[model samples]
Target: MAGYPQWHTASEQGPRARNADAVSAYAAAGAPGITFALADGVGDDPGAGRAAQTAAAAAARTPVADGPVTAILNAQQALRKLGGTGDAVLVVAMPFTGGYRIAWVGDARAYGWDGSMIRKLTEDHTMAEYFRTRRQPYSPRMEHVVTTSVRTTTAPEIGTTEVVGGGLLLTSDGVHKVLPPATIDGILADPSRAAATLVSTAIAMGGHDNATALFVEPPEVDVAAIVTEPFPTAA
Candidate 1:
């Protein structure tokens, strides 16, 4: 099974009472390999959830052999099928024998944690990021400011990276906002128990939207140290 361990959790609270995020993945130990995808909808948009669902499902349905570009295109096509312009941002992770491939668009993010430190893997397409780079104040309100998303005329900016040996984490804005990155990194370092606690922590810390976290421990992992038993299917 490559000794990889993964955990996912989501919660809705504080602001957007309705969770507009969706996640889907197909992972196997042997032949086909591991593939994971997550999408988060713009909170203000009523149809964002549908767009996310459409995109995530599309990405997950594509052939496991497809590369990042092809997988993303397939997801875009799926959004089109739902009459969605792709107003949702998506993050995808596919684990192979050597490592994993990561691709993303919009604001949903991917984070990586080595044994000691955590690194952000994806850039956000939000205005706050622009402000941060320009040395300007980023109002908390700017969280709602999205520069790009899945839309008919707009092509999302895509970035791809390879994760060779590290813990990869993916999340919607809800999870990141409520939890500090260092805290998130610690959880990824020891994801088993922390994965479930994170969900509750977000909700407790005023998760004003749908909170989601996907933790992936790639090949060569010490599974015995993480997953002790099967994740509760109902959760």
Candidate 2:
């Protein structure tokens, strides 16, 4: 690999939501490359925490030859067998030969940063997106609901994209839903505390759900404080 990625992460439970979200990043001796997994539990039970924890650990330890889909599918099965009854949004990223393999279920997402532009690589399984794709009117109430999740029989979509030369970001919906892409891009421009900024900003903005953010680009973070700039007043 010409360029190896450096990684950083930030995850926090939303005090208001009874957060069951979990996140893990690891590199094992025999694994092809490092692995990153993020899971947001959807229910209010002990199983929710178990579901997220199981998925994150299983996904990070998947064999390099098993492939991303198999890894996640296996994770889901493991969760069920272990009596994890809660549903969750799961996203995994692992280094491949030249790029990275990404797979996700529900609304958890993976985004690529090709130095200049940030590209979303996953389509959310939500009703709002469904109506938007068809150019139909839909209520905002449907926006936060996911049509599919890690516990569903549906398969996660897997994609291979370059990350060695640029950057890769994975986030739970809580963070992305609260922070706009433009705002994210500004924070990412300075890799120093990128993940922390995302999580902190989301919570500051009243994100009611657990928030998590991970970045696969590495550097010595600057100790400078990120000042809050004023936004344009509404018309």
Q: Each candidate's root-mean-square deviation in Å? A: 4.8, 9.4
The CA lDDT of each predicted structure is 0.67, 0.72
Model 2, residue 117: displacement in angstroms?
Answer: 3.4
Superposed Cα deviation of residue 22, candidate 1 (Å): 1.0
Best by TM-score: 2
Question: Measured by TM-score, how close is model 2 to the native structure?
Answer: 0.84
Query: Model 2: how far is 214 from its true place, Å?
Result: 0.7
Residue 120 shift from truth in candidate 2, angstroms: 0.9
> Residue 176's C-alpha lDDT in candidate 1?
80
After the best TM-score superposition of candidate 1, give how far the Cα of residue 203 lies from its true spot, in angstroms: 1.7
The Cα RMSD of model 1 versus the native structure comes to: 4.8
lDDT of 2 by residue, 1-235 (tens): 2323566788777764466777876555544456678888877567787788788777767765666677688777878888736767788876664456777777888888876667888887688988989999989867888887777745634433334436788998889999999888888887758888989899999988888898877322311111212211100
Quote each prediction's TM-score.
0.80, 0.84
For candidate 1, list the clashing residue pairs, or say none.
Answer: 15-208, 85-150, 85-151, 86-150, 87-150
Task: Give the lowest summed-lDDT range of ten residues in model 2.
Answer: 226-235
lDDT of 1 by residue, 79-156 (tens): 777774436778887655456678877778888778667688888867888798899999977766777665431334
